[model samples]
Target: IIGCSIAFNLAKLGAKNVVLLEKEKMTGMGSTAKCSGGIRQQFISPANILLSIESIKIFKNWQDEFPYPVQYALDFRQAGYLFLLHSKSQIENFQKQMALQKKLGVVTVGFVNTHEISTALPYLNISGIVAGVFCASDGVADPASCCAEYEKQAKMMGVQFLTDVKVSDIGANGTTRRKIEVVFTNKGSMLTPCVINAAGPHAAQIGKMLNIEIPIICHRHQTIATPPIKWMKKNDPFVIDYDDYAGQEFYFRPEAGNENTGYQLLLGGHEDGKIQIADPDKYKEKIDQDFILYLADRAMNRFKEGENIQILTKSGIAGLYESTPDALPILGKTEEVEGFILANGFSGHGFMHSPIIGKIIAEIALSGRSSFDITGLGLDNFKTNTRPPAEKAIV
Candidate 1:
């Protein structure tokens, strides 16, 4: 999605001769196909919040915003995102973050007490919950539809796409100067002055070909979809058990349903301190049995109608997240190389941030810098080991 969005924005910026190369037979066959597709602006980092705000604008008004004649449905929902807070410290931190969000023009975000939360969602067992922060503008969308629309718009704007073409190496002019000259791919070599590293989970490998150490690693995450239930609320908001009580942190949201299936949900989360660093190409694609059992038990413990829910095992999927040290993306140009821009390491927020990041990267490629400030997301921070404050919201 990021790559396609970059291409589309580049074309929109009047840059011709833009070409997108995909290793797979099609675009969005990697982590994008497996993402949970939650879009929210509740973040501690100002940079991420700004990116989300910009992207959500497009997601909310793509028909008016995008220049495509045939705009596809993104299946976007503004049912809101609620964070279940348990501790006083968590509440205090959220208060500060919510204030920052409000200052940044996020008027939909507000604090909700435990009673309000229970009143809103009657099925939820708010036993240990203290308070919650809800963002009415935050919601979910269909990742596949978004990517398809991006690809279509970009192609219509004269951006060329090459599928089943794997990039093998990057060539520079000389040892003294770092400048991109050519890209060697499986099909053939192509000469291009600029290259954008939007390889998703396989981004580090691409950086290695240029002999630049991209500070990114892949982590495995899984999500599951449950069969439709008659009692399921179609307009239910996306809910997150923010506090890691008993080492379990779960999140769930309603999935679109048909007449046959009344209403369903998509649910998953991470266990506290369980970091499964994985190979992007070699990791397990199926969810673990133990994890499935754990989610079922956790759901039953948290919701009144959870016991009646049945997991669609075949609907379970796992994907890789190209993560960074501070839970933020590494964008902008790298000092080690010229004509080589970095747009990697979104840490699982790639789909949500794709639209704005696409425009920012196009600005960097065509012009020298982005219209938005990206000083906090540069690669120099990792080199000097002086990073900005980490983003606190990651599920």
Candidate 2:
């Protein structure tokens, strides 16, 4: 999705000869397809918040940008995001985060006490929840559809796409110290002055071609979809049980609606405090039995209706998240290579941040810098040991 968005934004910026390559047989078969599709501005970092704000501008009014009669629809729903706070420390931390968000012009987000939460979502148990930070503007959308539209518009603007093509190596002109001259692929080689590495999980492998070490690791994230619940509403806000009581932190949101079967619910998040590093080529594509049991227990504890519904183990899907140490995407041009740019290590927010990342990458490629300040998102932060605090507001 980030690659397609970058191509689209490049074409939109009047750049000619833009080409997008995908390793998969079709686009969006990677993390974009497996994502939870939650878009939010309730982040601890300013860069992440700004990215969400800018991307939400397009997501909120996708039709204004894509127009109607198009093949793809985002299926966007602004049902909001509610982060349940349990501990006093959690409440205080969120209070600080809310203040930061308000300072950053995220005025629509506010704190909702337990009473308000219970009033709004009576289905919740609310046994230990003290408060919640709700952002009505932050919601869910169809990532696959959005990526498809981006590809379509980019193609309309003369951006070429090559699917099922694998990049083997990157070659630099011998005369220059660090300048990419050709991209070697399985099909053939293409001469290009610049290359943007948006290669999600395999980004680090791609960086090695130019001797640029990209610090990213792939973690397997599993999600389960429950059978249609009769009481489930189509407009329920995405709920996050942020407290880690008994080492269980879970979240749920109404899945795509169905008239015949009612509404299905997508449930995920039961951190076991172990990083399950995954090989991009080989990893379990199904949820673990233990995790499934954990989610079932979480569901029963959080909601009154959870006991009646059965958790479908077969309905689970898993994917990889390319995460960095700081939980922020590495963007902008690199000093090690003149024409090489970094758009990798989005953690798990790639789909949500695609729009703004595309624009920022285009700005850097066309000009020298972006209008939005990405000073803190550069790879240099790691080299200087000045990386910002890791994001704590992540689900």
Candidate 3:
């Protein structure tokens, strides 16, 4: 999605030539295809909140913006995100985050007591939850479909996509030293002044090729799906509980398949003390049993209906996250390399913020400036040893 969106926007904005290269056979076959597709603006940090707000606006009007009735239907829902707070400390933390969000014009976020949560969601067992934070505009969508839409538009606008191709080297002509003169791929070489490293979990490898260190590593995040249930609440939100054992996360969203399937859920969360993998292409793709049991046990404890949550399918997806130290993305051109824009390291929020970042990257690739002010959120900040606020909400 990142590569396609960047190329799409660049072509849309009248770039003379644009090309996207993908090692995988299909577009979005990387982390984007495996994403759970949650979109929210209830972020704690300033850059995240600002970027998410703008991205959600684009998602809200995505269908109308494209208007390809057959090829561009966005299966998006505004069901919101309900963060289940388990303690006074968590509530206090949410209050602080909520205040910051409101200050940043996110008035849709509000706090509701645990007692009120029962009234809103009678199915949820709220004994452990002390309070809740909810945002109506925060929602979910089909990211793989969105990626295909961007690829289609970009291709129509004359952006060439070379699939099953590997980037071997990235270097600038020694004479100029200001632009990426050519890109060496497995198939052949291409000359381009600009190159975007949107390689997802394999982004670090790309940086290594350019002799620039992108502080991102691949970590496996697994997910599971449950069988269809007969009963469900109206307008049920994606619920996340952060105070479970081992700081374990349990997040699930409503996913409906065919009519016979009734109502189902797509659930997953991060396990405590995750290890970084050296390679995204070689890591385990199967979901582990221990993590599955951990998530299902928490689900059954939190909701009465969760006891009936049977494994709908044996298949599950384990996506690799291109994580950073601060859990924030690295954007903009770096001092180490000129004309080589770093658009990787989104940790796990890449899909949700793809819309705005595409625009920002488009602006940067064209005129060397971002439309949205993200100077503090760039690699430059890290170069100065700035201690930016850590993003707490990643579930």
Candidate 4:
């Protein structure tokens, strides 16, 4: 998703011969396809809020900016995102966080009282929910279609896409190490002055080609979908159980309304103790039996439903999170590598941050810097013994 956007922005900036290389047969058919399908701006971190705030601007006006032949919309429904709060401490935390979010230009994120949450989602059992943090601008969208449209617009602007391609090696020729000279792929070689590492889950291996070790690991995240049910309203904001926000609990939304899927509820569990995979290619794509049983039981209890509800995990799907040590993205040029810019390692927020990262990358490629400050998110944070504090606001 970010790669296609980068190509589009580069072309718009009057760059000649921008190209995209995808290892998969199609763009966004890998990890991005299985994304949570959310474009939310409700965040505790300043870096994440900045990225989503700018990204939402482009998404809100996507059709006008990137017109396509197909009659497809990004399906951005501003239904809102409701995080159920369990404790007074959580409410206080959200009160403080919402202030920061608003100060960072996120006007839609604020605290919604228990009565308001009940009014919006009357079907939910809000006995445990003390209060809620709701953001109307933060809701679900069709990530697959969004990726398709970006790729389409980029292609129209003369961006070349080579699918099923893999990078073998990369090196610089100039003795002073000014810029990237050539990139050797499995099929052939392409000589370019610059290269952006947007390799998704395979980004670490790609960085190894230039002998740069990016501290990113692929962790399998499992999600389950239920059969169509009328209980969940189409306009209800995506819900994150408070207990699960910092622990293993369900984070769910209305499954996208599509031909393949019916009126279903799709959900995922956050397993902090999950084992990280060395390679995404080798990880299993199906949910584990033990996890499936636990998920099914939790699903029924989560919605106060009976066993006959039959929200099964028989056909669960899994994806990889390109996670970093601090769970934040690495999004700038490294001091060691000259022309090889870093735009990967978004952890699990790749789709949400793609818009800002793409524009920033284009700015850096054309000029020398970006308009927005990205110094804290650069590679210097991961340099020798410089580990910063971790951000734990994830589900």
Top-down TM-score ranking: 1, 2, 3, 4
Candidate 1 segments exceeding 4 Å error: 245-247, 259-261
State TM-scores per candidate. Answer: 0.97, 0.96, 0.95, 0.93
- Candidate 1 lDDT, tens digit per residue, 164-259? 999999987757768999999999999998999999998899999988888888988888988886656767788999875455579998886865
lDDT of 3 by residue, 1-395 (tens): 89888988898789967889998788999999789888888888888899889998889888554524438556778889999887888888889999999999888899888777888878788877778999988898889888998899888888899999999998775544556788998999988877888898988888888777888878888888876765553247888877744566888877766555556778888777654464776887888787777778877987787777787547577888888888888888877667899898888899999988888999998999987987666776787877368787777
| Model 3 whole-model lDDT (C-alpha atoms) | 0.82
Ordered from best to worst lDDT, the candidate numbers read 1, 2, 3, 4
Model 4: how far is 195 from its true place, Å?
A: 0.8
Write down the lDDT of every candidate, Cα atoms only. Answer: 0.88, 0.87, 0.82, 0.78
TM-score of 1: 0.97
Write the number of the candidate with greater lDDT, choosing between 1 and 3: 1
Q: Count the backbone clashes (under 3 Å) in each candidate.
A: 0, 0, 0, 0
Worst 10 residues of 1 by lDDT: 63-72
Give the per-residue Cα lDDT of candidate 3 at 367.
92
In the range 163-262, model 2's lDDT, one tens digit per residue, is: 9999999997655567889999999999999999999988999999988899999988889988888767888898989976546579999987676666
lDDT of 1 at 10: 96
Best by TM-score: 1
Local distance difference test, candidate 4: 0.78
- Worst lDDT run of 10 residues, candidate 4, spans 255-264
RMSD of 2: 1.6
Our model 3 lands, by Cα RMSD against the true structure, at 2.0
Error of 3 at 33 (Å): 1.3
